[model samples]
Target: MSSNTLSAVLEKLIHRLCLNDFPCGYGTWRKTKGSTEGAETEETDALLDLLSCPHSPWRQDGSWSPQTAALRQLAVLTPERLHTDFIYSYFTTLHILDKGVSVVDDGLLKFSKLEELVLSANKISEIPAENLPSTLKILELRDNWLSALNSLTSCPPPRLQYLGLSSNSLGSHDVVCHLTGTHWPQLVCLDLSDCEFQNQQALLDALSTLPCLRTLVLEGNPFTLAPSYPGLTVDSLPRLSYLDASRISPEERCSFSSLSKITDLIEDRASATVSVGRVRGIPDPSMSLDENAPDFPVITYGYFITYEFLSHQTVDLCCSQKVSESKCDAAHVTEDIFSDADLQSNKNLSKHRTSKLTWAECMDFSDTQTYIVSDLGGLKRFFNQGLYLTLEEEKVLSWPAASEDRKGGKEKESPIKSGSTKDKDKKKKSVPDLVQDAPIRRTLGSVHVPLQGLVKRGHKVDVLCDLGTLHTESELEATQSLEKDLGKKIKEDKKKEDKESKQRGGSGTKQKNTAAFKGRGKGNKESETDVHTDNSVSVQLEPLTVELSVELEKWQSAAEANQLTLPHKSKQPDLS
Candidate 1:
């Protein structure tokens, strides 16, 4: 071992201690002169006097030289001193932080009276049970590289009360079995947070044997995301008072009382069913236009709902492993193909490199015209934080009488434009332009429906969300501008078409019979008058209120005979 190692440094310090005598004090053996003559006094009296002295070496000092503190502490103790005396006379806590300790050796066992051993933020991979003292009550090995506890658990400290093994890789189920009450019977607090433990039932069942456990921290574990979570753990272990630093209240205890039954304790998979129902109270866009017009322009509307929700899906480990292997092979092949001598090739290779893998759950939002029924992986997200549903209205205006004219005009212009421009130069217009030309859509309002309370009602419940009669200023302004622009464009197009028609009819009708020509001209004039009257009309619209219903169903894990079946949606209903 290196001389800078913890065991080596401690061993070297112990060798410098005075073993034959109490190095801090002077002793004198004298007979009592009053009653007994020639009687010798014990040497312990001098040792006690030295301990009580203000300048005793055993006394800790804030001003003590850091280089000599270890030597002074060693000098005050002798080999013959009792472990209990050492504990009471000196310190019983040993804190070693950020030390490059790769292994725990027997050198620590020399501190027989140690009650607390904190070896946090070290590189320790193994802690042999023989190296641990029986008197230790608190053992904190946080932020270490420990992957298994077999050796330590083989002979665990009998009186251990608090064990902090957080931020380690002790994720295997077999390793967790050693943490039962059979090993550490007196354990009162245990911290296994940030570990890789994936099976919740196994961990909970193993920890339930602890008779005195009160505080348990299991945060940052994969199983922590399970919907059952703290409730399942609380009910499984009735003696527990605190979970992940939060105190379990009596009401929570009562709610999870059913979980205490062994029959009810089953492993759960992440799955849920969300059903969006009928929407009501959509405003008529035609109401915003003039009511007493001669001829009203045809107005069509399409309504849809947009909502953001948490979608959970479980990924197969085997499939992920295969994918990762294939990706690695592909990367190797690409590296071989691109030579290091070519700087440009290297840069191009870097651009194509795969990004870091992620397993995070993100929010998923969808837009649908009617009711939506989706099967999600879990309802944990909804239970933690609710979702929002937005109501949107789409309005499309069409002039049925002039539809044929517009189609004929587009057909006549298509061939001329196609012959003038090359195929590469002829690009389609962007989406915004198309949207601005015809349809106008805007959000009516959004309602936040909290699913937490609804979940408590039952496994499945219907939720009615009311989007109040409030629309944002931006939405109202955009809709108004779109309507005004569309109306103006329609009137301008109608006027141009009327002028062209009069020019064409003027020469032909004048050359023909006068009576028939006058009748035709009068009919054309009346049609133009009606179109002009419709264009001059306008109306005020009232505030819109929207209400939607949704059905949410949650499925919990079950045993072989009690398997849960998810609600199936065969066909979506048209709520438009």
Candidate 2:
């Protein structure tokens, strides 16, 4: 529109032409030794002559077509005189094939007489409708990557009668909507073959908007794959005279009843495919698993069908849309007053945010409980501790106790079943050692499983082992607290006993009692004897606490080593 805009457009064209070979030699016309007007006149005449003749010394082999020869001539033509008002009046046709031409410059817009433009096989990603000459009647842009055709509706060629958009990516419905009857009243021939359109019916429905469309090319498309493609195309567009390369006739037209049945079958197949994709519990094909692996246990009567159910519940809570939308700043007030966070704060919550428990929290390695306490809170309470997560694989949950015993590289023989009297006594002593090591061979928590088949099979399940040998960390802490309380009580009792003795006896006897209590308290041997004699609580727990501490340290080390050997967990199957 402006002189600056015209100069910029001309500059880009000059850059493109410089990248390719000049058909008439670059040096012959680039630096013309004459007046600017004379040089302009000389180049304009040469270009028009090249287009008109279609035969030249450069293409003497007759291999180059007339359109191909004209394109090469125009590409090499110097851009120095393109801005001149009357310079474009000489050229009526321009074909620039494979020249990487993306933009049609405003300089080209001056071609008021341009009737044909062939820009096939170029890098143009969009239709340059605004810059196209109004006199353009035939425009071919084959093999271009045009994703939008809406621009043509906004600024179309006033006298455009033929359009070729073959091999482009014009698949969008919005693009079809733009090419309506009102937008291009003079449009007659439209070539959209080998495009990205897949839906046959939708394309035909959109094309019906073009009231003047006579010649419609839809070859090399999904629509043509249909059995009744010829009949359907003709019936859809009653005025389409030439369909692809074939001429349509009245005898080929089919009845409306046949068309109805064909549409119904295609629609039914499409809907069936969509429904199958929505099914759940399907394993991904990319992953490999053992063919002999046991099938998932059927959920007889449990809260969850699989581990996925528990995980999904927690995921839904943590990743809720409301939580994401709510501002993180403390000053922000959420619209939902009764949100999870609000309810938690009102009830003085101190635990983790979500109700779902972590694997570590579910385990309690204490000897106080009769069963290994996996805190499935609501599940345990509602179902009367009926659910027991059985380990499908042994190594997943436990560290082998035999591995710890084998550290010394000494192999122990199995105890004889029917031995002598001496062998019977040795087996009795070794029995306690085996019993103590049994907990290390088993897991601490439940293995979640599916309940689909189990419900129909009527199989009975119960807690296999209580795991009473392992003491929880909480139990150790409580033991330490009790020891402290016992020591304090002993000190208070000793002081009270000395005060009572002073009131009943002489000063000399009272002094002896005070000295005995303080001096005896500091001596380890005397203090131990006093605790056994005077304080029953401390004496009984001291030996047990020492034994438990040693066992806890050994178990912790074994647990860490076994964790390192465990394989990474696989992605769970979707059990929707």
Candidate 3:
């Protein structure tokens, strides 16, 4: 590329990567004000701003204009600095996604201080180890056309902690064998998903050498179809904390302990049953009240379960028209709920709308839920491809006044007034009104289940999901208090600004006033107490967990058995 093209691309990339530090366009400094004095003042301010920016390396002593100096520094795109005065030493992170880079050229070595380099979704086919900086900790080359990793294996970055090579063509066992700890001693995470490796045992054995490899992704490989699967891989690499993006749960590790040795007995096809049980250990709101407060509102609680899982079954659009319509209606309700001017006034309405949407998605009314799996192979593939299975506890809280109103309404409608005693005794009881205000719903906690390991066992599997509440009442109170304090501080600053403006008595010139306004705006932007208002509340608290139980089992289907027993057709003699 030409120098101008390279400069523009680099400037745009830098601006995108450091958006917070350089909010304005890179060429903003080139614009001059109307008057000479104003232009000088603005230029001085711009130079100061550039110097103060966290990402900019331009010094105030530079002979060229601030913008020109920055662009010149970016223009010298060599592996090593062409001149001694270049500012490449300040670069720490470089992200060039989908940039059509066909090679890991020597130009990248200019960034001596670079730590995180992401060149994902590029046209690159090879990564020369010598072109990489020694200080790199994160190197991602995902979605590239790389087939061999000899360059990386021959000379790896010593401090490399993360290496993303997913969606490549490295399927050969010889190529995978280079992923040993000897090459990348400090590699913590390695992603090789969708590489099409076939040898399960060899892949696992190679990965087992990495001492600090806590996370590994081997999905989309043919070997994932092996009956042993994740259990074998898990047992082989005992130190792995995560496999294929799913956390290695303690239960899974315990169940799959030494499972690699018994791989021969594992079945290819099996039916499995999974059940989610009731939740417990929810804190009672009434327990926090004192005995003397008898008149305190009656606090009521309702519970439900919500979960998310990858469904292998494809949805038929023609059959799901009614479901789609209902979802659309729910979407409209959500928009209406959030559009209200006063959120507190329509809190109940919003809660109902949110509940309706949740129910349409994954909310379950029953305390217990069950699922059966007949094809272990299909389930294993879903799990291997980073399928997420989560169970959550949802709690609904009803205020005392609402509960009392409901009770009073029931009592007033219960008795008959205009009838004889016999008639009144024979009268049927009145039914309660169906239209009631919605209760406040909150998600207490959720847990991720390792389904791959569970199904691999091919028998009954019981799992206890530990749900932890992210926030407490005390934490909410503290957050509210902090927000109030920030509001007060903002009000006080505004008052001070108003007083100062009043003291000027409208005597200030337009330019000075404009400058003053810009200064105030910048100050407001930088203020730590500038509270950002959002629809949701934020709070922090210690983990308070509740437990729910789940059970799972697998069995072989009759169709699979029949297929295995069917004899192959014999060719007829002398048919030709």
Candidate 4:
């Protein structure tokens, strides 16, 4: 039973349900809630279970009824229901025949009014669609044993939208040819996710023309085919608004700010080899990172390739000089050699394309760096072996390498000797001589050498590594031995400076101190002199007191005539 049939059946049942005509197929065995002869009851448990089953029914009786059906809208399976004649008479709108139901055939055409059909998770090996109804709109056929979709050609429902054909075992040309034929007119959402599509060209070409397609989800699909690289779905789905092709290794969430790995590319398959490609990130639309920010990121990049035979075109740094002749060999060069044809006329440029390495040219620098770092801890030794560094160890060995023996076991000495003659005109000033790489005496008791070298000759002898790092406390104290060498010089200089300062200063240094003390002493003497003068005056005042008293008595007599009391309490404060 399809959705149309189910809907019609439900509408009819809701309007008029005869309980006497249809009691559930439980056979009156389960305890009853009511005893009314024709009263309607809700079959919640039985009805829900029936929705997912085949076109059969458990009727209003004590047993199963494969012939008769009962429900609001859902019609369920009664153990075994196969052909159209069994379920056609009943009306159902949404039929779910999935998983174990591999028995459907032209019997599906019986539900002429179905709007939604689901037959997923089944073992349906083949579907002959000659009897497909036109009323069908939404169809779900996921997780099935389907290999071809070509059956939908003639009777393809014009109103079909939201088709979900995911998790199907589809792998054939017919499926491709059928889906590629015409646009699903009303189709807006198609979920063909996890279908493992092998024919990507046809799929992309067909889907690009879908006028109504807006939402396409194709996660976990291996999307690649002939002449095309994997992940074309990410590029071809132009109208898709959301994409989730995150990496498979780390289930961890993405850190979009670190997406600046684009700088590693100088050429890519999409930009260099193919005419079509998706932008790394859209500025106006957030198709990549920092969606809240109103700017699209620009990817920076460079490219590389593997070289089969690398030669040189200019002076190589490791070029050997003929000792007696004192001249460099022209065969050695500064860089890799180019093909004769490339040097003359760049034959590959005839196609009006700028010359660049394809996947076939030179080795990637990352791989080379990884190799050098693994063995030599950095690229320093790799470059030295290739372009510089004459090895003394090669000469010290009694048994030299076959190549060395064939050439002659003699080694080239460094151009410079320690603190030697300054006749620089006798030699060309290239990089520093290897002899300078010997241990440098930085402290008193022990010697050390620099781990790094001059980047250029004219560069200053600035500290590469901190001197403090190279010494222990004991080692630092050992360097105090320098004070012994400079003992006489430092003391003599100090004495001379002290003598000169004393001569220039004269006696004025003590004059300021002495003048301050002298002023204080004079002030004390002045106070002492005043005290002495006061004492002498007091002695003289003692005799004059008698004369003053007589005068004071006479004055008191005069004051008494003016009504003043003798100058006792009258002239004094009140002690009372």
The TM-score leader among the candidates is 1
Per-candidate TM-score against the hidden true structure: 0.43, 0.36, 0.40, 0.31
Backbone clashes per model, in order? 2, 9, 7, 37
Off by over 4 Å in 4: 1-98, 181-183, 224-235, 242-576
RMSD of 1: 21.7
Q: What is the per-residue lDDT of model 1 for residues 207-280, given as tens digits with 9 covering 90 to 100?
A: 98988999999876655544455567877889999988889898877766755454343344333334444444
Per-residue lDDT for 1-576 in model 4, tens only?
Answer: 542232333333333422222232233422346644343444446554443355536323211112223432233223124233434444334444443655445655766666777777766655555655677777777787777776655567788776878878664556665654273777777777667664455666677777777667554343321112222343455554444333322211121212122212101111011010111111111122244532111222221111111122111121222234213211212232233344224221111111111121121111110000111111111111221101000001121121122235344333333244664434435333222112222221111222122111111122111112122223334345444434554466556555655666756754654464456456645755564455321111111000000000111122222332233226522211
lDDT of each: 0.54, 0.45, 0.53, 0.37
Which wins on lDDT, candidate 1 or candidate 2? 1
lDDT-based ranking: 1, 3, 2, 4
The TM-score of candidate 3 is 0.40
Worst 10 residues of 3 by lDDT: 567-576
Query: What lDDT is reached at residue 102 by model 4?
Result: 58
By lDDT, who's the top model here? Answer: 1
Instruction: Give one digit per residue, the lDDT tens place, for model 3 in 1-576.
Output: 533222344445444433222322233333345544533233444544664466766432332112333443343222133233244566666676776667676666766878988877877787889888899999989998889988777788899999999888888867977988889899999998777676677777788999999999876654554335666777789999999888998777776676666544443322222333334444444433458643323344444444433221111212212344335322121222122233223331211111121322122322332222223333444444322233333334333332344454342222334368876656534332333345555666556655544433323334545555454444455568776776787678767767776777565654566577668767766663354343224433334332333333221232322232232113211110
The true-versus-predicted C-alpha distance at residue 266 of model 2, in Å, is 4.2
Between prediction 1 and prediction 3, the one with superior TM-score is: 1
Candidate 3 Cα outliers beyond 4 Å, as residue runs: 1-40, 43-86, 225-227, 266-576
The per-residue C-alpha lDDT of model 1 at residue 174 equals 79
